[model samples]
Target: MSNMHASKLFDVKDKVVLVTGGGRGIGEMIAEGYVSNGAKVYIASRDIKACEATAARLNKQGPGKCYAMAADLSKYEDIVKLIDELSKKEQALNVLVNNSGANWGAPLDEYPDAAFSKVMNLNVNKVFTVTQKALPLLRNAQKKDGVARVINIGSVNGVDPPALETYAYSASKAALHHLSRVLASRLGPEGITVNTLACGPFQSKMMAATLEKFEESIVGGLPLGRIGTPEDVSGVCLFLSSRAGAYTTGATIPVDGGSLVKAKL
Candidate 1:
């Protein structure tokens, strides 16, 4: 009963968090949740303008502050630079959200050779690399009673065959989900936790084209009868980062409104 209250249990106040690809889309939503709840959030992306703009906007709604940085994390050098920059600003990192990703769609017969490598590199390889580079900071945030968090934003496509033919995207996310399990097992003993959220359809730029073309069909097929909202993603994020979720590691919780369950029509 000492910390049973929701405020104390789910509090992320003053936690140093770094969210990559946070300039827009799902990243922006998650960042806003932390900043508004008093977590010192740092958002990064390759687009300097978007990063700067997002930071500026979120800072205005703060009990916590948001910082912006630009880095193309697909490259090893840039990953190193990003971590170095964050290290200079913060001695420790309480949460690291590996949210930036990419996708490519094409018929299997016409898929380009470079699509697999490029998409996989950004969606899977770079996440591992960024987490590796950020280990020291994560370690510093670790403690006997609490742990550092690594939240990888994944897709339900990884959990099931997607409605679209985003082959490489599905493959990469599946790989990411497994990778999170491996990392979680390896790091849990050291006061760190790694988890992935197998998201369903959210209103993201990444999903914009598909939604525009098939909104009705997609909504109709979902068991919950709707797509995801910003609150849906943010609420899950806060839970995972808070004390309430400290015991969860290597989990791939779905944020999809039971879309993977399919409608029983």
Candidate 2:
């Protein structure tokens, strides 16, 4: 095949995609990538205003379209409502990005029970619930030669010990990574793929405080000598969602600017 044909391998044209917590950060970057590539994208979040604003902005730059909806994934009821709304909007879903997550930081002894529970509920439990509920839609979206995709947003903290005190967050992400493997094995025969993106650091709201506090040290320590960019993440997401990554599943890919590699060194 020609290079042009190979380039088309990553095209997600007309794919129906849902990105949880797609209002900002990595989720927004992923959503924008799909929208730019002609995928019909639905970005959801607890904050409707943020989702709407992001959708509006992405739509202007799109070959596809972006829609916004509000749903708090921490609540099972809200997850169901979001699915129902999505079902009304589209007959099937080609991609599901479980990007809605939470994190809490404090000294181990000072980390309250509520904080731990909240992080686990949002990061681990909700991700499972949302994926489970979306299975039917995923199945519906599966093409005879194409597979539906489930991309979970994990963290390097799950792979390596945290540099700071974020115990619950790390544990939840570790669980998510494991769950992705399990789901991949279960969903493989059904023409679906499940994978996790173990991200390092980026300029997201979640990392804003940490980056501000230790940007110099973090950047200097990284093997790549810089933080990750939206393009770095979005490119990987597109690859995974497109035919280029059709044969891959149950894999934990680190889009961490070699942070994980340096951790062991």
> Who wins the lDDT comparison?
1
Off by over 4 Å in 2: 1-4, 143-145, 263-265
Q: Over the full model, what C-alpha lDDT does candidate 2 score relative to the true structure?
A: 0.92
Model 1: per-residue lDDT, tens digit, 1-265?
Answer: 5698999899999999999999999999999999999999999889989989999999999988999999999999999999998999988999999999999999999998899899999999999999999999999999523659999999999989886889999999999999999999999999899999999888888989999999999888788989888899999999999999999999999998987777355
Clashing pairs in 2: none
The segments of candidate 1 whose C-alpha lies over 4 angstroms from its true place after superposition are: 263-265
- lDDT of predicted model 1: 0.93
TM of each candidate vs. truth: 0.97, 0.97
